[model samples]
Target chain A: GESVGLHLPTLSVQEGDNSIINCAYSNSASDYFIWYKQESGKGPQFIIDIRSNMDKRQGQRVTVLLNKTVKHLSLQIAATQPGDSAVYFCAETGGGATNKLIFGTGTLLAVQP
Target chain B: GAGVSQSPRYKVAKRGQDVALRCDPISGHVSLFWYQQALGQGPEFLTYFQNEAQLDKSGLPSDRFFAERPEGSVSTLKIQRTQQEDSAVYLCASSLAGAWRTEAFFGQGTRLTVV
Candidate 1:
């Protein structure tokens, strides 16, 4: 029953506002989770990541929260800008030596100016 | 150092044709990864390489998909007898594995269109 999913398929918010993207994963053994932002015709870029040992991690203008009990992960973007518009994905890397990443469905975040 | 680089930014091939995509990871990076991104979809892991050894390749869809990082630096993904369903953007990522943990750097990607 290992699966990764996004809570919302799409999200829209006004510029300068805060945006929260949520994800749910069923793999309890997963130890590392990362959020990536992918623009059109581009590769997914790393945003933030959290280890299973920790519940939260923060990066420049971005924060990631992990809740192992509910298998939930969330990314909070502070002062969302129009340039932040892209498809956000949650990927889990664990369970083996390869540390292959298992991706979620994704949420297309559209920043409206 | 510069970011990861993937060649053949765009490639079009017939259904039965075979195609090779190249990836030049960041200098000194010991971990290499390959992923495929379909239109409107997230990147799916295809394989991973540590140094010159491919530690895992369970994500490879089929035997037709072959990947190699002989020198532990540059890598290549070859798809034999391409199919229409194989069309997507191939991404390569590199990470420095050591005491200092860091994020993986991605390449622009190679978009392969199979007709």
Candidate 2:
């Protein structure tokens, strides 16, 4: 079965440091990927997204990198802060008409001051 | 209104009971989606609708689970004979368009507890 999974279950980072969260997906047909941040008692907030045509995309203080060859994706956060602490999820869509997202187990990001 | 909204932020249902979760998408949004999130796990796709038409329902766990978006706006997810395993947060999301590249906005979700 096709699955999207994280390389690390949790990632602890010092404040002001950079944080990297990684994900591995099995579906080659998946063309759209998104990174979402979910805080306690809240819905998953969209952080950034990338299409298959592009290998990387950047947003405010965050970046998403995609490696089609390795079926790997990563989210990079610069200057990690306490507010950035949350469970991060990587989701993919087959780019079909339905465009239903398949999510992976999340990675808890803890920022230490 | 501003974003996707779910009703009854918290729900407690007895085993074998039925529960209905509601979702109100943003105005004029063309796509609606339902997902189930278990404790400490990411949200899993449940069903999807394009406008008033149900486009995909393969992710529905079983026949006991059903969803509807009759007007292509407000949607509902109903669980029949709820089980303990059915306890989770039900999230609803909507996108401006049904395109594959569109971003989906999510609601805070309705937390369902089956006891």
In terms of lDDT, the best-performing candidate is 2
Write one digit per residue (lDDT tens) for candidate 2, span A1-113. 12233543878889999999999976899899999999989999999999999999999999999999999999999999999999999999965656689898888898889
Candidate 1, residues B1-115, lDDT tens digits: the string is: 4889999999999999999999999999888989998877778889888899888788799999999999889999999999999999999999987223456889999999999
Give the runs in model 1 whose Cα sits over 4 Å from its true position.
Answer: A1-8, B98-102
Clashes of each: 0, 0
CA shift of A69, model 2, Å: 0.2
For candidate 2, what is the TM-score? Answer: 0.95
Scored against the native two-chain complex, candidate 2 gets a DockQ of 0.52
What lDDT score belongs to each candidate, Candidate 1 first?
A: 0.87, 0.91
* Alpha-carbon shift of residue A105 in model 2 (angstroms): 0.9
In the range A15-103, model 1's lDDT, one tens digit per residue, is 99999999998689888888999888788898888888899999999999999999999999999999999989998875444457888
Cα deviation of A8, candidate 2, in Å: 7.4
